[model samples]
Target: MSDEGHWFYCLKHMRVEYGPGCPNKDRMGPYDTEDRAKHALEHARERNEAWDAEDADQGS
Candidate 1:
């Protein structure tokens, strides 16, 4: 994707970055907006929890 107006959560620096700052490996994603990038960790955690719940349901 074009790195024009995307946002990323830098895992190495633990901060939100606009456009391109760090390498792709150290970043969370190309979030659509700055606010979403800022909440990357929270969103990841929530997604993980949901996936875990789905797994549990399947196992039962």
Candidate 2:
């Protein structure tokens, strides 16, 4: 790919086509290179977990 920071979206659900009514669709990065994309994906996972935990605690 010519673009170094090509966006790769997260697909949390098995079959949810992202958008309204779909599950998680929050973007976490514009990571550069394939290796960075992997890292960014990991970051996204961690970020989501932390965010969810914080929200859960807040809701309690």
Candidate 3:
């Protein structure tokens, strides 16, 4: 698959960027779509919540 012109959500800058503007460690991903990249933070929050709930359930 061609990786040219990928989209990423920069955690450090809190913005969407095309191609490699920031380091991978500080970015969300080379998302398939720009819209998906834009929702990176929301997805992260959902995953975090799910993980937290799982942890609580395991603890109990």
Candidate 4:
């Protein structure tokens, strides 16, 4: 978890569908900073608390 301004994506929408709705593919962050993106990941993780949501990890 390095502080680098990047975007962290997550399939929050899919997580809600029980792995069977709308492709379960989505992105969630346009974080202005890497630190922020990481925060987003944590927030989303807390919200979804699943392995799939964790896969939503991305940097850029």
lDDT of model 2 at residue 45? Answer: 81
lDDT of 2 by residue, 1-60 (tens): 222335333444322122233223444334444455446656778989999999999999
Clashes per candidate, residues 3 or more apart or on different chains: 0, 0, 0, 3
TM-scores, each model vs. reference: 0.93, 0.43, 0.84, 0.30
Kindly give the stretch of ten consecutive residues in candidate 3 with the minimal lDDT sum. Answer: 1-10
Clashing pairs in 4: 4-34, 5-33, 5-34
Candidate 4 lDDT tens digits, 1-60: 322344444465422221122321365445564465446657776777665556665421
Better of 1 and 3 by TM-score: 1
Q: lDDT, candidate 2, residue 47? A: 86
Off by over 4 Å in 4: 1-6, 10-25, 44-60
Cα displacement (Å) at residue 6, model 1: 0.8
Model 1 Cα lDDT, one tens digit per residue, 1-60: 866699999999999998868999999889999999999999999999999999999999
Candidate 3 overall lDDT versus native: 0.88
> Number of the top candidate by TM-score?
1
Q: Candidate 3's residue-wise lDDT over 1-60, tens digit each?
A: 334678899999999888868778898888978999999999999999999999999999
lDDT of 4: 0.47
